[model samples]
Every structure is written in C-alpha cells, then in structure tokens.
Target: DIVKANSREPISNEGDIYALIACCETGAERLSGMMEEFGIDHLDDLADYIIDTSYRGTIEAIAELPKGTWRNVLKVDGYEQEIDLHAALTIAEDRVALDFTGTSGLSNKGINVPLNYATAYSVFALRCIIGPDIPNNAGSLAPFHVTGPKNCILNAQPPAPVAMRHTLGQMTPDLVYGCLSQALPDRVPAEGASCMYDLPLRHTPEAVSRGDEQFALELVFSGGTGARPGLDGLSATAFPSGVWGSQVETTEAVAPVLITRRELRPDSGGPGRTRGGLGQVIEMRSSDNADFMLFLSVERVLNPANGRFGGQAAAPGRIRISRDGPDLPGKGEVRVKAGETLIFETPGGGGFGPPRERDPDDIRRDLDEGLISRQAAHDIYGLEP
Candidate 1:
C-alpha cells in the first residue's frame, strides 16, 4: 500500500524526481568526501560530537530568556476574511517550544503553508534570535520543538492550494518574534516588511503571437527592515530571508518593461530614536506596445510594520496605475496598458525607541542624503527649523 501510494503521488512535474535524485547523489558524495577529509572513522560519532557542541551552545543561549510562557496573536489579511495566527511560546531552562494551536483553518486560496515549511521558518526565527551564528545542524535544532493542529494554516494537509505557501510561511519570523520580544525586551528587532514585494509579470498571448518579444519573468523588491534596539533599520532590504532586491539593469535586459523611476521614498521609515528603514518607489511601463499582466501577493499594504517598545509603525505600501487610475488591491492580477505605467511603493520597517530621542546628526544625515526630506526631518524628528 505504501509503495502504491508513493507511486500514485501527485507531482507538479516529472523532472522534479530526476532533479531530487541528482541532488541527493551529489550531496552523498560531498558528505562522504568531507567525512574522509576529517579523518573520521564512523559518521555517527562525528555527528554526535557536532550535535553535542551545538546543543550546549543552544542551551546557553536559551538560558538568556527567563523561563516563562509568552503568547502573541495577530491577524492576516486573508483573501476573503481575516485569518488569525496565534503563537504560544514556552521557554524552559534549556529549551523552547512554540505552539500554533489557535491558528486559522485552511484557506481556499494558495496561501496555505505546509507543516515543514512553517517549521523551517519557525526554527529559523528561533535560531536567528537565540544564536544567529550557530551551526543550523541537527544538534542545534534539537533544542526547539514547534507544533500546530493538523488543519491549522501553519500545518495544512494535502490538496490545500499551497502553491503560494511562502506568502504566509515567510511571516513566521515576525509572528514567532512577537512572543520572544516579551521575554527579551530589548533584544529582538521590531516588526519588518517580512515578505518581499515581488512582481510576477508576463506578456499577453496576443503580444507573444505578434512581432513583439515574448517574455515571462519575476522581479523581487525589498522594503525597509525593522529597527534594532540601538541601531537604525536598513533601507530597501529584505528581512528574515535577506534575499537581494532585483536590479533594474537585470530586469530591463530580460523582461519587457521600461522602468520610469526607482528611488527611496523620504520619510517612509517610521520615526524613532533609531529610525526604521526606508521603503522604495518603483514606476514602470511595458517596454513594447503590448499589454502585460502583473500578479501580486504581498503584505504590509493594509497593515504596516509595527514598532517595538515605544516606537512608531512604519508606512504602508501602495500599488496603483499611473496618476488617475484606481488603486490596485494588494492581492490579485492587474493589467498594464501599453502606454500605462504601474507604481508600487513598498512598505517601510517599524522604528525602535521614541521619536523625540533621535540624534540630530542622524536626522541631518537623512536630510542631506535625500533619504528624508528636510521638512520631514524637522517635523517628524523634532529637528530645529
């Protein structure tokens, strides 16, 4: 029965099996070679030693947070109705556990996140907060356990329309960190634009059939990262994932789009002692006289990145057709007419500390660099006129 079920399993593409097998074989050869280079007789013993060392470090880091239970709940802008994501974290002397027993049920859309994906991000968040530089091997991961109900959004069952799993999966770090912020007050950074602002574009079938160039591609963009306890947030950065934003030159070389303008938005970052990172403004139109489609699924449009401690929330994102066109929804597909331009203003990160405590020099630097306007620097940062 098991063999039959495995054989009957659904696959997106037949090439996937070949790719997985190839990767597996390559990894095995590499691992064996590495073991030989280490002069290890048995792999089990070596694994044990590595795990033990990492475990010890994990225990030490876990000790920093006082033993206690911290809980956090936030709402997701689901397609139909609001979805809830609840985290109940329990930290003991030597270990930590996160439970998602109260997360919303599965969604009809493609945002459902499988357990493994959710677990991967959840563990990643804990590792980032607990020991960012520690080896993410089996030993290091042994100290943490994450759980969710079978049908919860974080643990979707099969056939749950999870093609866009990362849409929700990427938000785990922020969700998990919310609980940790309680235990380690000033340690964790504030909420950030967790998910990348991605634009998946493709030419219309008619355009492809004509003499126009045929192209289908994706361009990923980043927003500001949340400010840390003592440091200002980074501008135009992808937090948690740390993936690079797409370069304009690279996109122009392949995709059929003409970029009109791309720059950092002034005062987009929230104001605080250590200001949040600044988001960016991107404007583009179809290069050819052909209409194109853009499919977007991202956050930080309706709900801006929230600040930590006494900080302020960062700016929310916006998507729309040029000047007079109606504002586009955060999720869904939209068409860009041949001569029409599309504008996307990505969200900024939440600030750290109070706005009144910001340094005058930092505010001045932002103004000189055009990261923030002089008016905003004076108004928001309480700078002298």
Candidate 2:
C-alpha cells in the first residue's frame, strides 16, 4: 500500500530522509546541503555509500533467486522461473544501513532469490513497518544496505537447491524489519508468518516400486500473521511476502487434488479493538491419485509471532493428516496416499485496538463477510450477532 499525502508538508523527519536518498542517487553534494539543513551531516557522508551498496546488492540478488532453483535445474519451461522484485526505502538520517555482505551464500534449491528479489522483500518489510507514509523509491533505499557471506543459503552462488528459495527468502523482510524496529518504534508492525507455508507436492511415493504416477505436484495455503498496533492480527494473509493466492481452478487443473472445505476458523483471531485477521481451516485430498509428497516450509507452529502494545499473541499454525482420524501431528514434510486428507489451521493475527473499543459496525461487517462467527463477534467484540 502507498502512503497517503498529509494535509501539511511532511514532517522534517520525512523530508530529511528523502533528501538523503535523492542525494545518494544523484551523487550531488546538494544532498549534503539538505542534511546540513536538518543538522544531519553524518548521514550525508553515508547516504551514497548506503544507497550504492543496497541498490547494487539488491539488484544482483534479484537476478539470482530464480536462476538457482530446482525448476531451472530440472529444465522446466513456461514457469518462466522469472520474478519481478524491486526495492526502495526511506531514511531520516544516518540511522539505517543495508548490508548484504553478511547474508548466506547461494543454495541448490529452486527457491533461491536473485539478490534483487531479496532486496525488494527486505525493502518491502521495512516499508510495511517503518514508513507506510513514505514513497518507496531509490532515494528511500539510499540509507540502507545488506550483505551476506559469499555462499550462504541466502546468498546462493549456483547449482543450488533454489526451488524452495522463498521458504527462507520471505523471512528477510521480517529479519530486516526487526533491525529497523530497534531504530523506529511506533512505525513497525509486529512479526508475521515470515514463511509462506509454501510447499511443493509430488508423487514421491513411499514405495519406489510404485513409481512416480502416484505422486503429483501442487501448492497449499498458509496460516495467520502477527497483530499490528490497534489492529487485530490478520488470519491467513501472507505479509512481508505477498505471493498471490493460487486460483482454485488453476490448482485443480494443474494437479490431482480438490479443496473439499476451506473456511475461517471461528475465534481464531486474537482479541483486540482491531482483532487479528482470522485464519482458515482447509481440507484437501487427491482426486486422480492418492499418493503424494508434501514438501513443506512453514514456521509459527512452535513459535507464534508476538504482538505489540497490550495485544495478546496469536496462536501458532498446524498441518494434520486425517487418515487415522482426529487432530494429527503435522510433520514439516510428509508422504501421503489416496483416501488421506490434509487439514491445516493457520495462526491468527494479533489484536490492534482494545476489543471493547471495536466498532459495532465493523463487527457486523465481519459477521456478514464470514470473517467472524456470530459467537465470536459477541464474545470478542461484545456485539450481538
């Protein structure tokens, strides 16, 4: 989301950050002049240096995420294996720095991110929590920088397993945002799912003798995110990593599966004036085949994202297979067969405003949209269904 213009000029803090970015990009001493105007000469000297490092490192990383994945390694076409990622930031002075030199080296997974993509996500995280009102651009990015080890998992070199790169890539935003939060409070949101719960499905049957036909490839859904200030946490919305939801038709047509039931988990959202977004409970099974391998990358099951302010923390996420019946323990990744169904209950977002202060109309609207159950509305928001 873009920041809206305020009625008056942006506060000096905002202007000084922008001026620093502009100077870094233009290589003009004029930015230094602007910094002097704000009593921030230290930032002027560091602006270009920060921008140069962040811009170059981010661009370079962008070029790499897709190229190193298993998809490219396997020689698959049409998937393009290409992604569009960009970076922009806002700095008030010499307060922030982006450093890629300390990041992990390249990996062999198909999910490895081009340095640029990593930069984009990192910037995005900062954007989401730092200065939602600031325009994201090269100038804003000027004061930050990132660095990684020559060949760490985050900084994959080549011939790495990149197919599941986003598994780790998506966390950069939160990681970087964590750093920013130390410098800018009130501006940052709480931590989120970080990992997309993205998984690759394949017919990697337990019995190799059965062959690959029993295996199928596909995608899955995610759980909830951490709560924000005055806003209840969001359930099931991928934050800091907004990969588009896979269309039902697209998913069915591409793989041998169908979504039997997918709906919000009642009372799943944490209580607050702005309650967390509710997570959903999804059930799925194989249509054409029963056997498949769930290659998963998920977090928050053991450690849920923490909430800021007085808001309580949201619940963790979980994935279960229902062959034996009832709540099953979710293995990070598992193999399954026909007749087996997978059930996933994502985490809930933290609450923002006080639950008692929630608008009655908003409660009614959530009930109308199936976001909050009638009971939840009454219990959490003190509104009758």
Candidate 3:
C-alpha cells in the first residue's frame, strides 16, 4: 500500500507478508534477550529482525521505481587514491536487493563500511527520494534487499580498517542518489559533504613525540546542505548522516592550531526559491612550528555534485595553502606541512528553484548576514545593488 501510494504501483499487503532481515551481530544471546523484553517466544517474532533493516526498506523503495531508473555511482577517497565504485540496483517480485558485488575489497586503510552503516545510508537515500511519505517501519521495508559480499569494502571482514567507516559510508547515499537522478531528474539535489570532515588527525608529531607538549590537531569544517523542494539548504550543517558541525573553539582547543577565519561563503548556494545550502571557508594555521597530519576523506573536486532541474553544481571543494600556493590533492588522505596555513573551501548546496524567482527581501537578508554579496543579490535576484 505504501509503495503503491508513493510509486503509484499496485502492491498489496498480504497476510503472509513479513519483513525478516538479520545481520551477523544479531546473535542468539542478544536475540533471546530481545524476545524476552518484547514478550515474544523467539527472536524471529521481533518487529524488525535485522539491524540493517533500514537498508532493506531503502532498497525496496528504490526497487519500486520503474525499471532502469536507478543509476549507481561509487566515490572512494582516502589513502591518496581514488576507487571508482561500480554498483547495481535491482528488485525481486516481493523483495529488493542492492548488490555491490563488483566493488573493491577491504583495504589496508579505514575505508570499509560496516554492513549496518552501509544499510543505514543506503536507506537514507531511498527515503529521501522514493518513500518520503512511507513511515520507516518494518512493513515499509518488506519489499527490498541489500547485500555486499564479505571482505568487500561495503562488507568488511574482521580486522579490516574500521576506524574510518564513516568516510566511505557517508558517500553511499550520494552515490545511489546520483543514480536516482537519471530517473527522477528533479528529485535529486546536488551533493554536499558526502563525507564529513575526515579530521582523523594526531597532534603535531613534534609536540606529541615530546609526550608533555600540548598540541592542536585540525579543525575540519562543514558547508551548507543541498537545497530541498521548497527550502533553502541549511548553512554549516551536516545532513543525510545527521552529524553536527564540530565547534570551532573545540576543534582549535583539541589541536595546536588556530582557526583564523571561518564564515559562510556569500552567494555560495545555488540560486532558487529553495536555494541550495551555503558553503564556508575555514582558515587554520599552526600556532607554533608544529606539524599536523590530516586524514582527508573529501570529494566534489573532479565532479562537483550536479544540481537538479536547471540548477548548477555547487562550488567544488578546494584546499588552498598560504601565499596562493598551487591546488592541493582533493581526494584521499594527506599531511599538512609546518608553517603553512591550510584553507578549506567547502561545497555549496544545489538550487531548488530558478535564481530569478528568489524573493528580493530574502536576498537582502542574505546580504546582511554576509551569506550573499551585494553584487550577487543584484545579479542573481535582479535586486538593486
């Protein structure tokens, strides 16, 4: 019923219909306890059987879309290399499956996505696009499937690099959403921080090696979210993953560096009624002669996340060094040398409506907040400069 209502397909809930999905973590001991708490005889009687049930519902939702509608794009970052992800989206009569069979295997670095986290983000994308109206319940997830073989990056085995699961995990929605755009062109928004600031850094080696010296790490920043149907993308927010932006003072305090300038980029959002999210510029430098290491899990460099309808892609993310130095590597992990300031220009949100249709009054407010420049307000919104 939910699928039919959302996708306009004819799917009825039968008496035998039940959603049963499980993960390796759902052991007998845990299941037994849950059964007792829920007043069920066995673990199977639980409302939802698996932890990654979210992904199951998501795949099912995506499957409800017409055939060949979903396109998958895999983006891999970290460890100074790029892995082009190849993915497939398919659905069975009563169930859906998201197969990442051909993708890369677990790596020495922490790029692996735990099955649960993978399922979490995969379903998040589907919910955002396909089944927004459907309640995220066991019944809503009855029709889909998701699986990647053990030892694969999406389904890593034991002893795999699990420290940075979020790095690759966060990209799954954007990857799947990128495919969704082919079928539902206007439904998708440009990507924002598919992966949040992968600021897994150690204190300056000089300070840390000394064992007594207090050192600062790095302050990774977030930008605006992609614009929604009728709302502007939020500034300095993390979406899809629902993570919060780390406080600048907290970040600076933890590390030996100082955040010089951190502010919203004017006119960074895509122009529209529901404008794309804004971006931000973050400046950081070592207070002393300390060295800092950065685990840069970033994207939107080569392919700035493209916007829907006629909206433009948000600004590409860039890493700038002091003295107008050459562009640094955009993807993977890298180190920041001593005495050089590192600046991160984050990506902006995709536009929801045409720029010209934006309200003049709202444009004025944006200008006041330094979110959009006076020139941009005049040019994009046709307001007086």
lDDT of each: 0.84, 0.57, 0.66
Which pairs of residues have clashing backbones in candidate 1?
A: none
Over 1-385, each residue of candidate 2 has an lDDT whose tens digit, in order, gives 1121222233224765889998787876776677778887476557666656655554443333222111001011111122222222223334344554434334334656656566677767754544444455675565456545545545666666566666556766655644544445455565666567655676554435654344244454666666565455666677766655445665665566777888777666666656676667877888876666776555556555555555555666777788355543333467666878877777676555467677888788778887767777777678963
TM-score of each: 0.88, 0.61, 0.70
Q: Write the per-residue lDDT of candidate 1 for residues 1-385, one digit (tens) a residue.
A: 0011213433233576789999999999998898899887677876788889998988888887789999998666666667789999999988899999899999898989998998898889888879877899988999899999998999999878898888788888889988999988778888888877888887776764575665667677889988998899999998777877888886786667889899998888888888889999999998877799899888878788888887899998889999778777778888889899999999898888888888899888888898888787777778997
Output the lDDT of residue 160, model 1.
85
Q: Which of the two, 2 or 3, has more TM-score?
A: 3
RMSD of 3: 12.0
Candidate structures ordered by lDDT, highest first: 1, 3, 2
lDDT of 3 at 343: 81
In candidate 2 the C-alpha lDDT for residue 184 amounts to: 50
- Candidate 2 — worst ten consecutive residues by lDDT sum? 69-78
